[model samples]
Target: MNNNLGLHETLELHELLLFKNTCLTKANTLSEVAQDQELKNILKADAKASQSEIQDIQKFLS
Candidate 1:
């Protein structure tokens, strides 16, 4: 996809991507030592979704 993003838009996209990356990392870290099975499951699911989101955003940015 052609980026065609203006400076402001590009910066906003970069910020959003960074935020998503941070959330994904947090989800992964939490899931690792999560004790409650249910909570762990939820975290894992969220992490999976976050990963997908990151991939999508990266695809768009690139």
Candidate 2:
């Protein structure tokens, strides 16, 4: 089955991957300095979402 995306879609996906990576990095940094459980949980959730987005981007690139 053909799975190639248009150029615009590919670029958009690339941007999303970059954004997700950035968010994951920020989340990790925040997690280390997080004093409250709620803050930590929020960062953890953001990191997870970023990871999921990265996976989706990978699939699209493939």
Candidate 3:
């Protein structure tokens, strides 16, 4: 589970992951509240993209 990442890289990646998860959560919430179909679609797309990003990160991890 360890790589050559220094402390700064590790912290930055951790922060990045947390931010991505937040984006996913916010997107899902906004998607529910979005009245316009177009806006809702965009929010759903954003959520999907965030999930894909998490999968990519998992690839880097495993």
Candidate 4:
């Protein structure tokens, strides 16, 4: 990935990566507290997807 990102672009990607990490954490925490089976399942799926997105963003930043 020859992403010769400028300072602004790098900062934006870092922010996005941080947001994804936050989302993953929130989903995991909410899933633990959620009583409904359906909601828990949804949160688990969201956490998994967030992890994937975070990895993708990291690749670009790297």
Best by TM-score: 4
Q: Candidate 1's residue-wise lDDT over 1-62, tens digit each?
A: 63587888777878988998999899989989989999999999998998998888787678
Clashing pairs for predicted structure model 4, backbone only: none
Measured against the true structure, the TM-scores of the candidates, in listed sequence, are 0.88, 0.85, 0.85, 0.93
lDDT of 4 by residue, 27-48 (tens): 9999999999999999999999
- Give the better candidate number (2 or 4) by TM-score: 4
lDDT of 4 at 51: 92
Model 3 segments more than 4 A misplaced: none
Candidate 2, residue 61: the lDDT equals: 85
TM-score of 3: 0.85
- Residue 35 of model 1 has an lDDT of 93
Ranking by TM-score: 4, 1, 2, 3
The worst-scoring run of ten residues by lDDT in candidate 3 lies at: 53-62
Every candidate's lDDT: 0.86, 0.86, 0.85, 0.92
What lDDT would candidate 3 get against the real structure?
0.85
Instruction: Give, for candidate 2, the lowest lDDT window spanning 10 residues.
Output: 1-10
Q: Is candidate 2 or candidate 4 better by lDDT?
A: 4
- What 10-residue stretch in candidate 1 is worst by lDDT? 1-10
